[model samples]
Target: MANADDMLKVAAERTGELAAPGMSSRPSRKVAVLACMDVRLDLYAMLGIERGQAHILRNAGGLVTDDVIRSLSASQRLLGTEEVVVIMHEHCGMNGGSDDEFSEALAADGAHPSWRLGAFTDLDATLRAGLERLRTSPELSARDRIRGFVFDPETGSLRDVESD
Candidate 1:
């Protein structure tokens, strides 16, 4: 059996061959976006961006955690990314509950009653919270631009939450 490194090397060579020559030579556009891992949200299509146009960082609720800060810092300082876009969508699964409630639900068995309460919850508060976290993060340069938007899954419209 091939080792993990050998497998990775094979994959990397295959991916390099598939990449466009311009993408392989140039750094991506100077934008770093944080968005949810929701299947309904299509980042490139929605933002009208093509491949290699931006650096996308996705996670649950696109919450601004420590790893996000580290990545954002590197993107700005090392990769020439000067803009941050936070895209939170409506009908998110990570809304309408405290962190404790979420942790408790995760720890419970498959039949936890609280799990039902967690679905299709209002995501406005969480969206605002994520925006605020980005605004207050010291890792961002003062000149760096940060903006937040809420994508309505029903209407397929994006609403600006805040801008900096």
Candidate 2:
């Protein structure tokens, strides 16, 4: 199995290939996409985005955490990224069970004892919570646009939950 460093080296090589000469000239659409870290979801291909088009911020469940807000803030101020797309997908491990259930499972598996899963099972509720979190975050620019989406992993379809 490849170690973390090995995986990183492979990723760097792939990124370098995509960022070769003439690739830097492609205009970025100034979009920020918040997506899950699920290997099954490809943010670039799903959005029809080419190289250097948007800034992708991924986490466990695609929830709008403080770090995401901070990154989005920086992207808005420095990277010309003003539009945000928060994508949560179907069949997500994050949504498979309740927070308590997940926490218990983690403990049973000898994971971190302090692990407390964030509640994100309800699709609509999770989307709304994420949207509201971004909208109300002081770190975000006042003029920034935010949208929510639900990606179907099985069908490879994107459904807009709410547009800006």
Superposed model 2: Cα runs more than 4 Å off: 3-27, 101-116, 142-144
For each candidate in turn, the TM-score is: 0.72, 0.77
lDDT of each: 0.74, 0.81
Q: Model 1, residue 94: displacement in angstroms? A: 0.6
Give the lowest summed-lDDT range of ten residues in model 1.
111-120
Q: What does candidate 1's lDDT look like per residue over 72-101, in tens digits?
A: 888777777788888888878776546656
lDDT of 1: 0.74
Count of clashing residue pairs in every prediction: 0, 0
